[model samples]
Target: MRGRNIKKAAYPYILWTALFVIAPMFLVMANAFSAADGSFTTANFARAFEPIYLAVMWRSVELAAVCTAICLLLGYPAAYFIARLRLKSRGALLFLVIVPMWMNFLLRTYAWLTILEKNGVINSALEFLGLPKLNLLYNSGAVVLGMVYNFLPFMILPLYTVLEKTDGTLVEAAQDLGASRAGVFFRVTLPLSLPGVLSGVTMVFMPAVTTFVESNLLGGNHFILIGNLIEQQFLTVYDWRFGSALSVILMLIILISMGAAELAGGAGEET
Candidate 1:
């Protein structure tokens, strides 16, 4: 009776997943494999592999990779620093890092426009300093900047969590064995933090690769990533079959990347 009741309680969640998640995926797959007249086809996938679309895919991966690397480099240090701080100070700094995320994501991305526009804050500062105003908005750099600003905390939080839980005794033992600071860090601290690093990389890279808003708002029409291509297919071109194919391809890329990251993380842990 108790087990039946427990199963009954789970029915709502199961139904919700089926309705929202599974049903949409099924529709996308059905559309991807169907032609305009509803006949089965593989042409959509083939078309997505054309050089033009492939270029967009490559650009998306490249930008996402750069964003992930930047976040890792910047976040690792910040997380390590915070992990070593006194409890109260650490909490305060972490709160500050998280506060920006509490704002609407669109609002945060829009806020960059005021800072990066030709007649915006940075240019205004430059003008005040008798320097040339830079054309900072609507470029690849601006897109990257927006990605880094938004996704940085995702990288930092995981790293901080892992570093905070790291055993101090390992560090002490490494030092007692006469390891240099760099050696201790590289040999002990870094290896133990691999899980967090992998988690953060996955979290940041997935969204960064598929993001349309930052690229649209910051990159303008001059720069088009895979996400933009997909959006254009669905909304502008009204080609659901092609759009569904692109979505499936993107999903496969993310899944494969995640599997690779997991394998790499496991190998690091074993080593």
Candidate 2:
């Protein structure tokens, strides 16, 4: 009776996933392989491999990598510090870290646009200080900044969760054995936190690679990533077939990356 009740409780979520996730994926696959006249064709996939598309794909990967690296470098220390805080302060600090994420992502990106634009906040400040106004908006740097700002919490939260749950006794034991702070961190804390690091990397990298809004708002016309190209194909040009093909390819790449991360995380845990 208990098992049946558990299954009944899960049914709603199972149905939701099927309708929203699995059904859309199937629809994408159908669009990817079908012609406008409804006949099966491979042209969409073929077109996805063109040199222009390949370049955009490379750029997307590069940008996402940079963003992920930056997030790791910035988020790890912040999360660790927060995790080590007193319980009351830790809750407040982590809450602050996550609060920005509750706002609409598009609105946040637009806010960055206002801050980064010429004659905007940063530029106006520079003008007041008699410094040259920085060309912050409409470039790769701006896009990366937008991504980092938007996705930072995703990286921090997982790390904080893992770090907070880490057994405190291990650190004490390491210290009792005469291990220095740095040694304790590197030899004990870091090794134990690998799972969280991997989770954070996966969370940050996936969205960074697939984001179109950040690139669109911050990169302007000067820069283009694969996401932008895919968006243009579907919304601007009304080419759903090619867009679906691009989506499938990107989804496959992400799935492969996630699989690799899971394997690496498993190996770390085993060791």
Clashing pairs in 1: none
Stretch of 10 with least lDDT, candidate 1: 262-271
lDDT of 2: 0.93
Writing each residue's lDDT as its tens digit, candidate 2 over 94-210 gives 989989978999999999999999989999999999999999999999999999999999999999999998898999999999999999999899989998999999999999999
Q: Tens digit of lDDT per residue, candidate 1, span 138-219?
A: 8889999999999999999999999999999999999999999999999999999999999999999999999998999999
Per-prediction RMSD in angstroms? 1.4, 1.4
lDDT, candidate 1, at 132: 91
Q: Estimate each model's TM-score.
A: 0.96, 0.95
For each candidate in the order shown, give its overall lDDT on alpha carbons: 0.95, 0.93
Superposed Cα deviation of residue 5, candidate 1 (Å):
5.2
